[model samples]
Target: MKILYWNCCGVGNPATVREFRQLLVANVPDIVFLCETKINSNRFQRIRSICRMEGCLAVDSVGKSGGFALLWRDGIDVSVQNYSNSHINSLVRLENEDVLRFTGFYGQTASRSRQQAWDILRRVHHKVNEGWIVGGDFNAILNLSEKEGGRSKPKVLMEEFCNILEELKLTDIKPCNGWFTWTNNREGDRLVKERLDRFVASDVILDKFPFLASYVVRQSRSDHEAILIDTKGSKPNRERMGHKAWFRYDTCWAGEQELKDLISCIWEKEESNMLAKMDMTRDKLGPWQFSRFRNLKYKIKGLEKEIIRLMDGRTDD
Candidate 1:
């Protein structure tokens, strides 16, 4: 299952929403965490429709600042565990067989005060136990190499950031590809860049799911790049609903031995009737297959919604 996370700054804007829709339609990530949405529950439906991720749960702040949300695609079976109503700290326990916990964050960027923010993260980490992923803009680099500079660190936030990582025993997943996710929009030699965005996972996550990949995509409008993670090789529970083909197309129809003869039979009846005959063939086969696919898709979607709703106790049923 592929999961993506990004601090869009504010998805409430129309242009940002349009760009997001394009990326989501192309990539089709299983789960996505959007940070700095700057939107509350009042405008979440706009985000849901624009992104097209059905059956999602969003934890929005009161105003247009420090909001974070977690969303999953329709078919995936994930149950949200122990989600409180805090704006900066949005935590969810995923009900995979391994009992995974995912916490989405938007840390404080201002100096000195970030310490309290990190403290809160550590508290949440210990409270949630091990097997979890902590991802977001920490606003503090974990190391000296994280920031672009010729001299020493500004306020030496690395030591504090590293201490947090050590305490939590979380591994930085996007070190290789993404050096700097956030950049200053200044011109000339005064340009500044920092690796503010991050995805850190516990020892259990590394040991259990080693094949999961992570990277950052370029954000067009926003200064922060979109972070994407692909959770490959993780075993999804198939026994819950049993296995069935997601989509089926007739291979037999592609290579009919007497294809010319079939067309000849239709053409002999009437020249104008040739197109109508092919249309008839499609009409007969297409609806059955398409309808079945749609029905199965809707059923899986409903099941996922039910699971999430039951776990979170927010059923409209």
Candidate 2:
């Protein structure tokens, strides 16, 4: 399974929306966590539909800022445990029956709010009963090496970031791609870059899926680069390779009463009793998604390229 998480810096801009769609097509994540969407529910609903993800859960933007959203394709099973502006916590069941907690997280940008972020993470960590993976734009660095081309990052914040990870026993998954994951998109001395986007998970995750790896996908459309986690893929080489073999259910499905009833009904029909009710639910997920949502896996590609083609044609004309 492949998981991609990004803080697209809000998708309200027409250009940003197009770029976000492009990023989705390029990465094709089975599950996606997006931060700072800055779009209301009405608009975000349309965006998720265009992206063709059958499942979605969203935290509406507060005025013009602070929105969080999670989108996932068919075949993946996710159940949201809890959520806040800082993170959306969920349980994801892998094909191997290994269930892990995945927190699509966003740390505060302001130094004053750093303590609040840490408090939230600590609270979330207390509930971890399984392997955990927390990821997104952290907005802070562990050390100076993670930052470059910028003024010095305060040591106190770095120490705090490190301390929280240690307190939670979560370690950064090594990046096979280049180190930095965000840039100011500037030039000369004005430029700044930092490895602010990442996946840091409990060691149990590595113990369970030893081959699991995270990569820094190149950034073109946004100032922040995207992150991809391959659950059972090979090592990440300098080339940033990825392989997809299974699906993950988006936790948002658990929120809908209709889906809950449907899952309960499916759970009731099991006679073999070998597979857990959830396991049976996972079995039904694929066909359910396909039947409910058209197979738009490649639809975005065709539409995006055609739109670009027309734009180029207009430019030439």
* lDDT leader: 2
Q: Give the 10-residue window scoring lowest on summed lDDT in candidate 1.
A: 308-317
Query: How high is each candidate's TM-score?
Result: 0.67, 0.72
Q: lDDT tens digits, residues 171-285, model 2?
A: 8997765577887877667777788999998989888778898877665677887889987667555542221112356676576676678787887774747467766676666
Worst 10 residues of 2 by lDDT: 308-317
Error of 1 at 316 (Å): 57
Q: Which model scores highest in TM-score? A: 2
Report every candidate's CA lDDT.
0.67, 0.79
| Backbone clashes in model 2, listed as residue pairs | 76-247, 76-248, 76-249, 77-249
Q: What are the per-residue Cα lDDT tens digits for candidate 1 across 1-317?
A: 56677888788878988988877876788778787778886687768866777756677665657676777777666666544333233333344645666776666767655766676677777676557787777777866666653345656667777877888788888643445787676644555667888788888878877777776666678888777766563356464442233223556545654544554565566655657887654444444445434586789768856643432231132
